[model samples]
Target: MPKKVTITDIANLVGVSKATISYYLNGNTHKMSLETREKIRQTIEATGYQPNKIARSLVTKDTKTIGVVIADITNPFISSVIKGITDTCTSKGYTVTFTNSDNQEEIEQENIARLKQQNVSGIIIDTVDANSPNISQLAFDKTVMVDRQAKKLRLDTVVSNNRESTVNFLREMKKAGYQEIYFVSFPIEGISTREMRYQGFMEEVTEDSSHLLILEEPGVEKRIYDLIQKAKDKIAFFTMNGPTLLAFMKIVNKTSFRYPEDFGLGSYEDLAWMDVLNPNVSCIRQDSYQIGVLAARHLLAKLKKEKSSSSPKLLVVPSESVIRNSF
Candidate 1:
């Protein structure tokens, strides 16, 4: 195997001192000429020499690494957000360590503690439960929340306008002649996007005349089918997550309920298969990738000690409500 090259080797080949090479590597161009900087960079690149950021961090006390805890890595929305974080962090010469909380409060807490122990300079967390006390109590110099919020905690958070978006979506559906609309929501005990969406719907809806069912568990598919069977007057159905929508679809198929004719389905999370499925699900589409990018930048700013007059802020992204034939 070829021997690994070092910065010293690049310095020697470029006829520059080690200090000069270090300065160039650190992007310190104030004293060095452009010619000299280019020569050192070219030499380093040609030799395939990589800087020892870990060793440098030991002396500088800046690891240049950000730890990220995602609610569920398997979810496309969460994964897209992580991709944004990775792209931004890598470009900024920082590394990322990612952990999955699996939507469990205990697991989420353990992961946060572990990330802190790893000496990550900052954190970008997609909280499993917004109400998880661990999230509120955890202390970090630089932290940002993505796609979730904690009203009790004083921290930077980036999330979509859940209430406004949901309310508008439902209102538009109602205007488009969706009568007897039914909503199926996840149980709201944990730190969840489910809660915000529910709140949004409730605030916009004054009349409780329509059938609105809140699911306490995953087995609410039967209840949905029963409602659809009995409430033949109802025209639309909505679900908060992909799993719930998928389960409901299964029940609909088993019960031989035709789509559009018998019922309509709308989803909150824009899962990949939503478009390909029969009848094509309508949804409120959130920008998870952009949320990730914003969270990373915010946390990095915090880590760099960037001062601002504003207090802990909530960055709200907008959601696009796709009007498919589901309505």
Candidate 2:
């Protein structure tokens, strides 16, 4: 095998000092003349020199790599977010390490600890439980939370306008003559995203806890069937997210109920499968990819010391209402 090229070889070939090559490698080109920079660049390209990231990180104390912990890797919405993060980090000349928590708090804590052990420069997490004690112990300056927020922890967060968007969509349902609207979800359980959407739903529809359908509860399908059968007024259902929407649909599909004829249907997440249905499902569409991009940029800013804010800020990304024949 041919010998590996080093910075010293490139410096010798370019007839420049190792310090000059170091400056060029670190993006400190202002210290050298344009001609010298061009010479060093050309020599390095010819020699195919690769820098030792581990050694450089030891000297600079920066890995130029970001760690990501995902709550649910199976979610299509989260997949898009990961795509955005990967694309942005690639363009910025940074590498990423990814971990999946599978929506388990214990797994999430373990993933976080593993990433920390790897000595990652910073971390971006889609936490399973925002209120988990492990989240509060993360380095606030180097960590950014996505999709969830802990108000007391004051960690910088990026999330959709869940409440505002839900309220707007439900109002549209109300305008379309939905006398009763039920909010369907798996469980709130202090999850900020679910709680915010539920709050938005409650703001638009004034109803008791009876209207809140928990999919995880026993006999939920029977309850939903009974609710449909006993309805006297024009009633509709608004699901919390894509997975919840799917579970709700599975229950409804078992019966002979149809949308807008038997009952109206609307949902928080706009998934591709929803559009392909016989009568497309109207839903609130969040820019999840943009949320990921923004979260990465924010973490990068903090890592580079470019962000001046001493207090953690909540950045809200806007959502769009996709009106369809479902409601």
Candidate 3:
């Protein structure tokens, strides 16, 4: 390796004091002349002076870094959201450190603690369990949430309209003459997003317990088979999320039941595979990327001491319906 370039080298090349160079690096350039600042910047570029961010952070008490905790990075939707976050943060002169909780509450809590230990300027959490105790008491000034919402809202959150959108989508299916609409999901246990989607289905679906199928329930396999037999005509299944939709599709493939002809299906998430499947699936297209961008921006605003509402605000990102033969 060649010699490392330092701020001192840039200072020498620009004929300016090292403190002046430091001021420019620290965003205190208002005290310096434009000519001097331009020369310094030019020298920095020419010399390739890579300042030690760690050392600078020690002096400024700011890392200019954002910590992100995701529910599960493996999921395509969550990954897309992270892409939006990375793009926004990188452009804003901030770096991102992301952690995946693997959809476990304890892991989510531990991840947040670990991120905090790194002295990140702010945190953006795509939570595993919305009701996690860690969520209720997070450092409000330095944290923003996305994708998931707590049972009791305490953090600034940006999420798609889970409940209202589901209601509208199910109503659309009903309008299309879907005599039996089944809500298929993994489990609503303590997950607020799943529960909200389930609630939306219930609002439009009435008190028909038979149509609400929890895959984790005992004898669910038999119940699914029975449902498939009953709805051989004019039956549509509304899945709560991507994973649930995948599971149901596996069964559909195994049973050799063709969609939009033998049956109809619609899901909450619009996945890539859903597009290529025989009759393209109709579903909700949520702006997952926007959720990530908004969450990071909100955290950045908090760090800048921007005025926010007394109550934690829930920002809803709109969802677009991707209509196709599946519904």
Q: What is the C-alpha RMSD of each candidate to the true structure, in Å?
A: 2.9, 1.8, 2.2
Single out the weakest 10-residue window by summed lDDT for candidate 3: 224-233
| Model 2 spans with C-alpha error above 4 angstroms | 1-3, 45-48
Instruction: Let me know the TM-score candidate 3 reaches against the reference structure.
Output: 0.91
**Any residue pairs clashing in model 2, and if so which?**
none
Better of 1 and 3 by TM-score: 3
Query: Against the hidden reference, what TM-scores do the models get?
Result: 0.86, 0.94, 0.91
- The CA lDDT at 251 in model 1 is 64
Q: Rank the candidates by lDDT, best first.
A: 2, 3, 1
lDDT digits (tens) for residues 203-253 of candidate 2? 879748889999999998998999889999998999999899899989999
Clash totals, every prediction: 2, 0, 0
**Local distance difference test values of all predictions, in order:** 0.78, 0.89, 0.85
Give candidate 1's error at residue 182 in angstroms.
1.8
lDDT: which candidate is best? 2
